[model samples]
Target: MMRRFEDARILMYSHDTFGLGHLRRCRTIAHSLVEDYRGLNILIISGATIAGAFDYRARVDFVKIPSVIKLRNGEYTSLEKHIDLHETLKMRQSIIRHTAETFEPDIFIVDKEPMGLRGEVEETLAYLKTRGTTLVLGLREVMDAPHLLDAEWKRNDVMRKIGQYYDRIWVYGPPDFYDPLVGLDVPPAVRSKMDFVGFLQRSVSHDHGDDHRPSGDYILVTTGGGGDGAELIHDVIHAYQQDPTLTHRALMVLGPYMPAKQRRKLVRKGSKIPYIEVIEFDNRMEELIAGAKAVVAMGGYNTYCEILSFDKPALIVPRIVPRQEQLIRAQRAAELGLIDMLLPEESADPLRFAAALKALPSRNPPSVNAKGLRLEGLPNISRIVGDWIDGRGGKEPLRVIKR
Candidate 1:
């Protein structure tokens, strides 16, 4: 039997360390939950560098964990403290377990990662399962391709783990376009627990407010985390330099983790351009994107959602290595006529990059058959979550209008 939303206490976990995507998505969902269930009390477990920047309702609270980052060599390390990786992970696990035990939430929502911060959630899930707490895994719309996903699943035993432990799997994207579980060989029983809740993105209000807009036509270049974005940034600068006639000014946001030396070099180089502005980081990305004519961004899920939500023409350069998830998302979005994708090989040529940017205006804006593709998923997702809590089966699939 489902519990009641207004009277329920929810525990949400988002282990965001490198970039703002996970943290932002989790916050959006939490906000939606609060809006739908007026009296909902949400406790967010996040490790984002910018957690304190968000303003939450009185019923919402957060536990900020130690931040961590993924190294180029595929290793995870702490961002703030210089502790050993193993020790840091262990400490994180302890905190997660302690939080779950103390709070005694009715439902537990784990975002992106199933094992939580370095497999921390595993301990919590075990404890919760024994204590009769509902466990749900919230996955982004797109994961990597079949081969990569298979390898990852096998290595992590994600399929088996989910089958045994989770009560529900909520995908934040439409299955009609891309079903994340398509080729995974999941059991029928496990599949029954899956729900495609559409894309969970923050809604854009008509009142964009008085955010500073660039004087002339300018391209916004951003990588959620500057760690893997240096190459993309370099290529954009090179592309602009190659063609002096590139009319648009460039605004590059070297994300928080971008090394000081690298940032200084980019700043110096951008100063020479006379048409470029560089900032270390800006929390108000939605406003910045709203004001831009076009966007050149790394193909992270959150950024893709933002571009679609704003109806802005975009040229996405998805990172290939480490995880092909971003590349897969870019390709899918391009296939759907939503955005343009420029692969790494194509981005190697300055002319190619220039051409992609120049052709942005021709691409069609994102559209849905229902409600005109206005990004209605946040509210609907919240409603469904509330219904489930209210002891409503929530068996019906949320309707989504495809373009």
Candidate 2:
């Protein structure tokens, strides 16, 4: 039975490792919850350096833990601090547990990471369970390759934790498109609690980036976080350099995590080209996407969501490194005729990239007949949360919109 309370609180954990996807998704949910409920409070625990970049809603604030970044070789390190990995994880664990005990939220949302980084949230989850706080595990639509994910989860015992800790498993995507847990052999009990909330719809805002907004119909190229996007950036620039007559103007947002030396080189090369604009970072990415003719990007979750939401024709060059999540998503989307894809191995050739860029303007967006496509994740999440708070067990049916 749901309780009737005028005021409620939510505490969400986002294990920020590579990009801003986790933090951005949580912030969107936080904003939605605060807007719907009168006296709701949402607290996000994140490690994103750019958490302060966006303007969060009232009653939605974040606690920034010491930032830790994942490197190319699958090792972890503190982003900008002198602290060691062990020390940083310990500190983060302490902060997370302390916040949960003090906040005493009615609901707890864990993003992506099952037990948090290095199992930091286990103790916290145990503590919250004892208090009867509603626990939710939120996952992206598609994780990584089934084999890879299965092994990783097995090592971490994620399946066991899912059964023991989570009250509900919220997959932030429609099941008709892709099931993030498909190959993991999810137990029936946990599967029954899974909610296929539609993809969160991103609002278009011109409130930001007016001064630096690119003029004219240009192709926008971006790599979420730019940590491993240096190759993508170079490829786009090479495409422009190779095909000088390619009339499409290009604007590239090299993510902030891009290496300084590499960024300098990108800027220097772009300076010679009148039609290309290179920026280090911009918080108003949606507005930029809104103004673009088409998109060329890596297949990060947030970027892909924004691309689909805006209905922009996109050519994805997904990474196949530490995780195949992006590559898997891009391949699936391609199969569904949603976006164009250039495999990582194929992206090395300048001519192939140039050809793809030239063809982007004319390629049609995803076919309207695409099945089970749901992009209204924000309002759906709000409604589900509202039901939970109102003690109404009934859920809103998944909203499926044609692509």
* The best candidate in terms of TM-score: 2
Alpha-carbon TM-score of each model against the true structure? 0.89, 0.93
Locate the minimum summed-lDDT window of 10 residues in model 2: 394-403
Where does model 2 exceed 4 Å of error? 1-5, 206-213, 367-372, 392-403
Candidate RMSDs in Å, in order, are: 3.5, 3.3
Candidate with maximal lDDT: 2
| Superposition TM-score, candidate 2 onto the true structure | 0.93
Off by over 4 Å in 1: 1-7, 204-217, 368-374, 392-403
What would the per-residue lDDT of candidate 2 be over residues 261-313, giving only the tens digit for each residue?
99999899888888788989988788788778899999788888888888889
Model 1 alpha-carbon miss at residue 380, Å: 2.8
